[model samples]
Target chain A: MTAGVTARTYMIVGAEPEWWYRDLVSCLQATFGTVLARAGVDPLSVLGAGWRFLHLPGDVRSEEFYYPCPADESGQIDLGSALAPHHQLHSRWWQPADENDVWREVRETLADNRLVIAAVDNFHLPFRPAYGDVHAAHLVVVYGLDETRGVVYVSDAMPPAFRGAVPIEEFLRSWGSANPSDVQDAFFSDSQIGRRCLDVRLDAPPAPLTPELLGSYLRTDVEAFTTATSTRTGLAGFDAFAAELVERCRAGDADALRELYPFGWGMQAQASLHGELLRRCGRQWNDPALAGAGRAVEAVAHAWTGLRFTGAHGLEDPRAAAADIAHHATVLRGKYARAVDAVGTTAARL
Target chain B: MTGIAMSSVKAGLCDPVDISGHRNNTAISAATETKAGAFNVWGNSFAAEYLPAGGSLVHVDGVPFEFPPVCDGPDNIRAAGQFIGVTPGRYDWIHVLAASERRCEDTIELSFADGSVDAEPLRISDFWAAPAWFGEVKAFESLVMHYPHHVQRGVPAMMWAQRVPVTRRAELTGILMPRNVALHVFAVTLQRHGQLA
Candidate 1:
């Protein structure tokens, strides 16, 4: 330990962070769910409330937890806002203020009784299935840092769900790894785990999701989708993105397919959650149209599987894969348009 | 019930179509030779020990299926729009032993002898530690997942017994698989329209 570093432990007062997960979501949503659960919030209700499509070309990162994050006017990226636009949820990425004392920030965050979302390479975490086999960047919730015991309390909800203590040395290696390229995992590798962590806070308790409240949120999201912005967003933005992706593949650019897998996951997971939430609300309120709209959104999520896997298997031959890529993209675009229409009609009634 | 009454209500009236000719993907592997199977882009496979033996007849939910060859060679059709011919007979259902790299929903074209074609939905859940989202019967499950380099525990590989309806009361001639590369079909069976007879 350093000179002023105390050989002590810090942890939250309540129970361990709950593991919240859906089959279609990635670690990005899973870790965020754990934090929200600790804050006395239903993970799905908030995470599944607002949904929109935003694809940033040349801005995709090779990480399992990568999501399209846009910076505000002051150049500060708030991932919480991007993920949950309907609520007062806010998040900002931070690193250790002192390179020499890397645990300083983690200790302070734990002491404040809040969870820390740490970025790490699965290759180094023993609990991860990719440990010593593949290199992929992922996220996990950190609930405790027992420097005295030389173990960090970690919780992950992704497949092969794991929670418990990890040795400090191994956690450090994973958290600070330079996740290099691996042939086995073409999509979620080649990204650096630069000890990045997300500090998320829900400033206000989410309002009970009544029909009126949900209708307003849906109207706002529907507007975002119908309106064209400077950035790649909404229905028009999706058209622009899909066209360029097919063009790049046809031109024999392999990088285009490489970026599609990670980028599509965020959009897919969002649609699935949003769809599930709508279906639940619909069933409770005896509104078949709302439930059907949820199913339409889910079809959008399902359609992404074809496009993503086609691009993945076609990585070896981009030109040859262009036809199938275009076919799936067209199919996905149709699903998106249909889903938007359904949600719009349902929203007006609500 | 009389003998005649018992004989009239017969079950197991399904023909297991031989799809050996269309097997193009090796998705099952023994723990010792995990490198041979490449089910997904990550080169993962189902553990052979936990699955039915090679070339066995397995019954799932009253439907019989001829299990594909296990460690010998490719055990599933990695759906690439292959067309499988069936005996021109009236059928009520098309049962399949299927799994996908992820939760997938696609369409399959059913061709009839009368030259009519219909597209039916083929939904399969993810094989990697995921539930059957489309309410498919869990036909077979490998307790462990076989990676190219090692056998991973706690992550089960699942194969679903899903069926598509042959709603058209016509003699089915052929079935056209989807162009999706993520969907895999191990075995298929055509159940005769016994109730109609």
Candidate 2:
């Protein structure tokens, strides 16, 4: 460890990389927490799960220059300026034109302060032009570099699969030759990973991804749908069918409404269909206003379906319209039940 | 967007071609490259060579389909127009053909809307899988139908899914984990039956 290296270096090296994109973001958040803790900043307040960071812009296909400080007196981070010592000391490196520039900027950044971070490119195994041809790119932290061993230790977001130090020269050459289109972004740090050269930890065991932890990574969209459906259905257990119906409606299934008309006479009938499910589940319609709005929408759909099916001639028969609306509503409810059940089964593991 | 909505109006069959016996024959070998901005539809196998922008050579129910100058030539075939305009509506009775077979007896009903195509009654026959590579070949001996959608939003811009019987082996292989399956479906709607301007 160097004089400026913090105790948190070993901690970051041990963490697992998350699989999903959101989980990956969470991993970044965790890293920031460690960084803030070392800086004597309250991790909770300054760096938590959803903290936003300043995004450095870069084009992978083009060799662009980046500067640490703002070109103007504003002292902002100017991406175009050359890398400097003070900038490097901050603990992270911005994207530079080439490997030579990355090395030079990293050295300067580290000299100013041990806090700097640099973004480095990690090459994958069995590389091919096809793999390099895509627009996807990965970001990793440069923890250390050993000149003699010719290795650059990286804290990759793609953990287990791509964590640890790689041959410095070979890594750079592979990175440089990568289809420029695939060069996404890099991370640099004046922290231990950036300055202290260490051996790539290939043998270091990976952290487990328990089911409980995986549940935490559930998609927000799925969660929102679940919550809404549960509230609307009021069923003690989640009604997969009703949820599917709502999803189909949200998906703009006009025929679904038409099919629902016959089962429910009017908007009130439709509301009851949703309301009864919720009531059976021991849930209350939390918002009366929303409940009223839902009824009104259902009424419009019921009336439209009736008119279309009965034709203008049949429009004179109010009974026929009512019967048609009820039939349609029943069909919609049936379809909703089936879809919800399927979706529930499919997503049950989550 | 408005034109897309208006263009949702379906056109009648200009020249209906039979598409039987094209699947599993490998009679046509064409290279398809997807590009940004405009879709490109080109193949080595074609009766008459016709080029169209914003279109790609797609495989539907084990059969390959070329758009614009539909089929192989300069006859001003405009079936690709279905994929051009938007407004997400279903179209019935979509068809495709290969260059090698002229019998054209193969018929498939394709319902397309919202950038996805579903080919029903088709089954997977054989597949190729190894380490990082995965590929599958599906064979549909019986009746084949297609339902496609032109997704302006949500998921893939263009998608096609087919169901076929397992008469033969389906082969699939790739390096990276395959994230998605690309299905070739048109995004045009049928406003009127057999009416094309």
Candidate 3:
């Protein structure tokens, strides 16, 4: 490091990053939504275009943005591909190259006029309701870095949304926090922030969503759900996941319930967005069948509340909660089946 | 939050049901005793200051409700298959002031005195700074959320007014709340059959 070298300042030119959010989504989708919106694309059209159920064993993390992203044979995972199966969006996780200059990657990304999705700890961020009270791993978009002013510009679209400069010291603490486990937040704590950041790119602008295009998308998703694979995906995968979850709960394994909260959140959020998009499309096109199918899919999302919350409250007694857990799992599975059938039938006609 | 008023309904068509025996959860707390409320798993609750007085009569869209006792003790009933028996009557709508740990859509069993039972949808939106996703009327809100240790500002808690239809023409004798632990019912009112209640 050269002595007396002035630190560079960078900020994405244009309006502040827009806060794109839905009630059901976590920070993962919210941050991605903001980035996609900045690229002149409707966040929902991209994020909600495809939906599938995938659960990788031991892949769940105690982070709000945790979503299962399987790696290829080459050991590389593309979160963007996992999120938008039908789009040219891609993302990669990266960390600061030099520990001495923790803000290097952020500066470079901001200089390139790209927004960075950085992992953070809620306990350290003043704007967070959990600030200094609870430790929870979360994600937020970083739009600018001002070394000269000693503040880092940040934006979060979640509840009590905040956008503005944060003291560099505070931001760093949150970004690099160990995020020790707090009893208050069993689902999102105990995960390390590790100064991680997600670099997202929309390789191509999405085409207008025509009826035919949506039909094709629905058909593909329907096929994915109906076709059975060795992976934990689709109806068969959900069956396996649910059975195993119930078994573990019966065995009094609390970890099963813990994982269920975060893992179910990802699935729940996806179902909600997909259903909302389909319903909107249906209404706009005046297609009652499609709208009905969307409602079915939304029922799957709503059913998740029962299962996830049951598991959440049952963390204290997995064995006692097993029956209720199994009940909700069965209910949710039925919803998935019905929604899949409805979507398939509607897609066939579309 | 104001409700959409339905015209042409009789002035005294609503009857506030007594659910005092079913109050099993404390969801509201004064700023001084935030720890007393545990609305969600996180021990968060609604601030008493922003709510109607305990045991007060509150109205939304001309539907009267006997708001449960606040801060004093259990103020809401966490749904767990509790069978709430009502006066046998031919009601058009069963209105409830409810909230859920998250946006939930479950079913409640409506038992008629004619020995027939029907399952009706009971949908409630998340109370954690969320919108009324189920098209429920926003009945009450705590401007600030109360955590066990402190009063958290900027995050508000919500209570919704949602209803389930008594589709059957027979008298409704009892309502079996779903076994779902996510739902919480604070108050209930029965609107007589007629005029868009």
Give the DockQ-based CAPRI class for model 1: medium
Best of the two (2, 3) by TM-score: 3
Residues forming the 10-long window of minimal summed lDDT in candidate 2 chain A? A47-56
Error of 2 at B125 (Å): 25
In candidate 3, clashing pairs total: 0
TM-score per candidate, in order?
0.97, 0.27, 0.97
For model 2, what is the error of residue A56's alpha carbon versus the real structure, in angstroms, after optimal superposition?
Answer: 13
Per residue, candidate 1 scores C-alpha lDDT tens digits across A1-350 of 21213547888777988999888899999998898998999988999998999998888999998889888898878888888999888999999989999999988788788889999999999998899999999999998888888999899999799989999999999999999999988888899899999999999999899999999999999999999999899999999999999999999999999999999999999999999999999999999999999999999999999999999999999999999999999989999999999999999988
Worst 10 residues of 1 chain A by lDDT: A1-10
TM-score of chain B of each: 0.94, 0.20, 0.94
**What is the TM-score of candidate 2?**
0.27
TM-score, prediction 1: 0.97
DockQ for candidate 2, C-alpha atoms = 0.02
lDDT of 3 at B120: 95
Question: Which tens-of-lDDT digit does each residue in A44-124 have in candidate 3?
Answer: 999998989999999999999999999889786788988899999999999899999888788778878899999999999
Tens digits of lDDT, candidate 2, B60-126: 3323434332232232211111212222322233232211000001112232332233332211111
Clashes of 2: 115
Question: What i-RMS does each candidate reach, in Å?
Answer: 0.7, 21.5, 0.9
B1-197, model 1: which lDDT tens digit per residue?
Answer: 66544433423578899999999999999899999999999999999999999999988877789999999989999999999999999999999999999899999999999999999999999999999899999999999998889999999999999999999999999999989999999999998887623
Write the number of the candidate with greater DockQ, choosing between 1 and 2.
Answer: 1
